[model samples]
Target: MSSDPWETLRAATRARVGLGRAGDGLTTAENLRLAAAHAQARDAVHAPLDVDAVVGALGERAGPVVVSQVADRTEYLQRPDLGRRLASDHGLEAGTWDLALVVADGLSATAVHEHAAAMVDVLLPRLEGWAVAPVVVARQARVALGDEIAEALGARMVLVLIGERPGMSAPDSLGAYLTFDARPGRVDSERNCVSNIRPPDGLTYDAAAEVLVSLMTEAFRLQLTGVRLKDTGAALPSAAG
Candidate 1:
């Protein structure tokens, strides 16, 4: 058995903990690991999303691919507001839809590239009876962009599947944001978010799908999202029961 009491805790999570020290600094191995994690987080932020690959992965489930008004990655980083609007009102046509699905390359393109399609695969099946719009792939996007897209598409609700901001331990974490009666000016309080959705070390695909579906069902019935809504995890069966 390890002498360190924190060893068991450290093994149970990806979090950096119980890292033994060398005099006044982190041990050489710990330092190297930290450097690698930092590099991955930076790369996740800077890397461009592969739109074609995402569309190919989603296949017929995907609709038109779109770009935010930010123009380039550098501008996207500097001007967050631009990312919330579409470049132009093209490809999308107005039609009444029960729900709109948007896949976006937010802060971490790697997250979307790796897990967005799989998430869609798991989520869409759960929304069987709903009139779900084809998935819209967005580049240089922010969470608010889904509002404009869904509004243009005339959807009653919008779900934006995006890459969450990369952290030291979770560079590929995905997130989902849901909004009811979506419009351009909707504030953060008007949305419900399901985050940290990268499996194995994060929320598994099935678990995240359950939460999102439950939120959507309630949002449609309640006609709202955000703070007023709650994910009681009621849709999922209880382990204790």
Candidate 2:
């Protein structure tokens, strides 16, 4: 057995904990590990999303690709507001849709590249009978960008699958934001989010799908999302049963 008691804990999670000290500083190995993690986080943030690969993976499920007003990665980082609006309308046809799905490269393009299309694959099967609009792939996007896209598509609700801001430990966490009555000017409080959705460590694809489906069902029934909406953990199967 190792002398370090934190070994078990360290094996259980990705978080940095119980790192031994060396002369009032982290040990060289720990310092190197932290530096590597930081580099990964930075790379996740700076990496450009491969829009062609994403659209190819999604195939017929994908609609026209779009971009936020932000010109590039540098501008996207500097101006958050620019990522919230469309560059132009893109001539999407208006239709009454129950849901509009958007896949966006947020702070971590790595997350979208790894998980967005896979998430849609799992989610679509559960949404049968609902009129879903084509999946919109967006670049240099923020959560609010989905609102304008969904509104233009005339959807009652919008689900934006975006790359969450990378953490030192988790450089590829995906997040989902759902908004009912989606339109421009919808506040964060008017949305519900499902976050940290990376598999084998974070929420699994199937599990996240279950939670999202439950929220969507309730949202449509109640005609709302956000502060008034609640996830009662009712989607998962009971242990007792």
Candidate 3:
């Protein structure tokens, strides 16, 4: 890995950090950016605000907000349903959004910032008349939060772009999950997930984005998703203008 940091330096260059070669196989720019990102992460960790704070803030309020909260890391973890909907609000019934997209702080906020926006940027224009709800930053949220978000938006399809669990290989990795008519009672297997969302990680942002949009578009046309939607574009209607 050390012998081949040329591509790494290019990516860093696009990210707009100064370039310098550090003795250890990594560019000085690479080390500096990583160090800065780590420092920011540390500060965020030490801050009083976190996924818990985000969830609590949502819980304490009442309105048309889609209730998104962490389920596995705090007091709410025990109550799977609370991690679901806000009992007091239940949110306005989603009437069917053009396209619903949820941005969650699943494993790393940095991941979402780095890749989710780019994926979503290209995806929205591909889908016909898709109007994305404001990108909701979820805290302590889970993979299933996409359903609730879809329900809140009353959307035909829900796609959640979140940070993947950090590994030594890729800390800021991103992932995506797409479901047709996602709701509270839906099963996990009902949705299609696209993971490892970074350049040369698993799928390129643009290509993976095409697949994601294609899945939802297919679902809308065929009225199905999951395995039923895979490689089934032939059965779906042509895209609307």
Candidate 4:
């Protein structure tokens, strides 16, 4: 029998559970790992998003990309309201799409840089025939920012792929939010979120895409999201399977 019960469980998930103690506190190794994760979380929050790289990775498949109203990382963190508006008229063609896809650097630029393009690759194809607006690449953005972007594009729905707040175990997790009838003043309950989207440790791109597609389909038909929309969709098969 293993002395640490968590050792066996740890292999099953990335969650930090059943960590054994050293003396009266965490083991030195555990403490060090925690500190490193904390540092990563902080770095992710302050990291600068490279909009051009994001655009390039996206392969210009959908449409033009644009920034949000948030001027800089500092101001973005300080003024949440600013991130929710459009920086300018550069927002793409309005009133032409059923969905507005937003890729944003929400707390973790690393998460966006790592997963945004891949997730889009999986998601966009699944949403074929649905009018998709330009893929908006926003910097220092919040979840609500997608609402205004969708509103600007006159999209019926806004699918925002942003970085989830960093945690000790998952510092670079990406999250997706889908809202029906997206616009400013919409509350949190009006949106549905698919979170923990980093591969190997969290939901893979394919799985997240599957979940997202299912939700979007339902949201459009029922015209609602958030608590009202249940995520009973099946996850995609593992790459190994």
Compare the candidates by lDDT and give the number of the best one.
Answer: 2
lDDT of 4 by residue, 1-241 (tens): 7777678788877778887788899989889988998999999889988877888999866465566677778888889888777777664666778988989898899899899999999888888799887788877688998888888888999999999888887778999999999989999998999999999778889888988888988898898888999988565564563
Backbone clashes (count) for model 4: 0
Compared with the true structure, all predictions reach lDDT values of 0.93, 0.94, 0.62, 0.85
Q: Per-residue lDDT tens digits of candidate 1, residues 111-162? A: 9999999999999889888899999999999999999999889999999999
Weakest lDDT window of 10 consecutive positions for candidate 2: 232-241
The deviation in Å at residue 134 for candidate 1 is 0.7
**Prediction 2 global C-alpha lDDT:** 0.94
Best by TM-score: 2
Off by over 4 Å in 1: 235-241
lDDT of 2 by residue, 1-241 (tens): 9999999999988888899999999999999999999999999999999999999989999997999999999999999999999988666778999999999999999999999999999999999999999999999999999999998899999999999999999999999999999999999999999999999788889989999999999999999999999999877546553
- Number of clashes in every candidate structure? 0, 0, 6, 0
Reference-based TM-score, model 2: 0.97
The TM-score measured for candidate 4 stands at 0.90
Q: What clash count does candidate 2 reach?
A: 0
TM-score of each model, paired residue for residue? 0.96, 0.97, 0.62, 0.90
